[model samples]
Target chain A: MPLRWPRRLGLVGLALPWLLPYAWMVSTSFKTLPELVAAPSAPLPSGLNLDAYAAVFEAMPVGAYLLNTTLMALAIGLLQLALALPAGYALSKLSFRGRGLAFGLVVATLLIPAQVRFVPVFTLLAEVRLTNTMTALVLPFAVSALGTFLIRQALLSVPPQLIEAARLDGAGELTIIYRLLPPLLRPSLVAAFLFSFVYHWNDYFWPLVMTTDDSVRTLPLGVALLREQGTGVRWHIVMAGNVLLSLPALLLFALTQRQLIHAAAGKAAGR
Target chain B: MKLLSPRRPTDPYLLLLPTLLILGCFFFYPLLAAGKLSLYSWDLLTPPRFVGLDNYRALWSEGLLLHSLELTLVFSLGVVTASTILGLALALLLNRPGRLAAFARASIFSAYIVSWVSVALLWLWILDADGGALNAALQRLGLPGWRWLSDPRLALPSLAAVTVWKLAGYAMILYLAGLQDVPAHLLEAAALDGAGRWQRFRHVTWPLLRPTTAFVTSTGAIASFQVFDVVRVMTQGGPMDHTNVLVYAIYEQIFLNLRVGRASALVVVFFLVLLGLTLWQLRLWLRREGAEGQSPPA
Candidate 1:
């Protein structure tokens, strides 16, 4: 059946609210301060200005924040992948005495909200004087229960004969994991990578608790700090910083749209 | 017994050691530490003095702890209900295979993937009292601008609204995946029986989507209870603490007041509440699935 024009219009109308803030963030970033402050509220900026973007860097150590965030995302994603791959392989493919218990413990970690661990983790880090360091930011999150679960599910779905054949060829477990599994588990690996990246990239709370200085602070915490440190309401600069902080993820998301959708659907199916 | 024996049966245990070590140190160890710390009274400066249940008692007697917990519950309820309903509606509307629908679906889902810090700031600008997009639109419609985050009464709802807007995309994606699993033949059969649209949805679609609903609601509730970034960015649990959720309260207790003991107690409570939620939802989900499995043929 041909969907009517009115229904199409309705869908677009509903979608507008979701789309507008993004447009607003971009637009407001380019707007002059007076235009932003003007009472009537112009929908678009009268002139294209690069002032706010410039000011964002000048006002704070935004470049360092961005770098720190990128590093954290990459490090955390890789670390989680490293930790999860073997564990997932073991949990799914191999027989061990504590297999069920190990799997259960990994799953149980999912139920423990990361927020509840904030104080104690912080305290532990403090005890070792690891607080306010990049290690502190990335270390606690190195192990991912969700990643373990997803990878285990992926490894389980692979035919047992593939690994069996490899084992028959005198392949060690590490060799099998390194060569055989990577290609097989590409999609779940991608999903896990994306999930961990997105989560740590946008993580504000743990970083906020752990880092006291800009040298190690990630983008989200830096942006919030930018707002708090502002003497007056500077929407343009703040919006500019928001766009800067959000752009990498948005771009990554837009580029990998199909894979992301497939990954999400796969996850939902698993659930 | 060689250390690196290739055919060793303990290979799985060896493989899982790194994960277990990290989780043990970070997750399990911290949990035990939190449990112990909850019973003591310490400000970071002083050595923790054991005061069994005093921190927990203080949390109840001081009353702000309860207030924050109540606010968290109310906030989670509002956001979960609104987001799930809106998400389901949008998913239904946009589930068809058309260019327009695809565009709309992508547009709707984009919000959820963006950073919450950015989402909070963008909405902060939109919900600004003057020159804000929302107030501006309201003014054009001849309505007076209202204090959204500034007024205590409106702060929690404003936070809830922002949360719903951000999470709608996540819920929509989940529902869309769930919708795909609903058997088309069953829907066709219901339609052939001359069932109305609402009747088909209520009886056929709704029942089929229960697992998805359970997944969505349970996860939504858990995430909402752990709400922190938006509140930290938007309100800082301010305007007379109307928007102070449990996580934010924990942060405040630990950082602002240096009440690590009380904060640890709060964390324990938060953990238990979350665990309880997961278990409760699991029970409900299992029961529903069980009932469906045992149902007589339609």
Candidate 2:
């Protein structure tokens, strides 16, 4: 499929706007303070340096924020998967009363994003005195509607006979689910995990509203505070913090582009 | 087929228990709580006091809510229009199979997954009034550099621009997926019937992409309304409340002002608006998909 030269040029030209900011971020992150101040518009620094990276740590508790964010994201992802798996399997493979209603309720939750319920959830957490805790970050999102829907879609394609055969061989409920569903649902699991991980990791709104102290602040919040507090903030150092925060999601995306794309594209692939 | 759950009628119920319990507590309870809180006035220090519809009345009479609502509309419209058009155009351009096209798609889509914090901060650097990349480019082109965030006129659009940059990739992926289902024979038939490229896309391709467009636009609208981080970080609803969107306004009301009732009222209003839009989208999707046979929801 040969694309016309003009069309190809247009596509590449359009793509540059998206790429340039990221390039500029990486470029500025390595610039020395003098170079950064001297040429803020410079597309490339005169020489690469790690001084800014070092400054990011000195400026704030970036390490602590990063650890908290990583832990929160991981906990949310794993918990969401743990809950979504059985729910998905039940919807797809098991016959139960009110299954349609349960599924409908799950899908209906999609209509209301977490932002809409921010106040109540915050109040509830505060009432429980769990504000500023890691649990504050992860508990609300432990059972994901989107995760359940996707996993169910994935499981619908799996042949029910396999589960039946296993059950007929004296396999218990746990055995059939654990032994048969894991391999079958691996792609959906990966897709859901990555989605949850990326969402929770970069999530700033929830963490911002929930946590007041630097001890509980995530990287994004840390960067936000760095900007707010540091009146004469250094762009290079701040960009270094931004780069460090974005690196994991970027790396994961690079490694799992296929699964991520498929996840968004839905089961149109019919896989 | 063997009856896998012959002896376990309650197996499905057991499996669904955790999900129901969690959602009931966190989701449903909060939903009702949000509603109930909206109907009353309670500063944390004071006992709860019921004020039927007064919060809602104050929200409107105060005018801040109205202003933020208008800003939110402008913001969502800007984002949806830019993302959908750009995304469709890019998807059309990259629909062809090739290494370069795939690379282009991947690179463009990468921005969608990057943290909003990073994107916001990076753009903060790029759009800085004096030393930013954008202004520098303007100077090179013999135009004066403009203050992107500081100017009230430019602040909202500037945030909208960043949003478009980040979200256009997501729209592109959805459109690309939609494009794959446009049967080759239908396209060829249209071509043979004297349909030009634009005509083909307008009549056949675009119509076929109704579901995708619906999904993209609806999701885009909701996501844009919920825009908090970028505004919070970049403008802090500022230069003159030009970038004060709904979610940010709610945050300010509840957290900054300690007006829980007002915040909850805003939440209820926002939820109703989104719910209306979502139901409309679902109706359109179901009708379109039903008419077009059994196409999967994108």
DockQ of each: 0.55, 0.58
| CA lDDT, candidate 2, residue B40 | 93
Candidate 2 on A1-271: residue-level lDDT in tens?
Answer: 5778987787677678878888899999999888977888888988779999898888888778889999999999999988888888888777667889999888877766788767888888888999989888888888888788888777777787887778789888777666778887887788889888998999988898889987888988887676776666388888888888888888989998998898877633333
For this target, which candidate reaches the highest TM-score against the unseen true structure?
1
lDDT of 1 by residue, B1-298 (tens): 0012236887888889999998998899988899999999999998999999999888899897789889999999999999999989989888899888888888877777788888999998899887688898888899999989999999999999999998898889989998998999999999999999999999999998887787788778988989999999999999988888899999999999999999999988889888888887767666765543311000
Please give the interface root mean square deviation for model 2, in Å. Answer: 3.0
Per residue, candidate 2 scores C-alpha lDDT tens digits across B37-89 of 99999886687799999999998998987998899999999999999999999
Error of 2 at B24 (Å): 1.2
lDDT of 1 at A70: 94
- The CAPRI-style docking tier of model 2 reads medium
Tens digits of per-residue lDDT for model 1, A145-165: 888888887777788777778
TM-score per candidate, chains pooled: 0.95, 0.94
Worst 10-residue lDDT window for candidate 1 chain A reads: A262-271
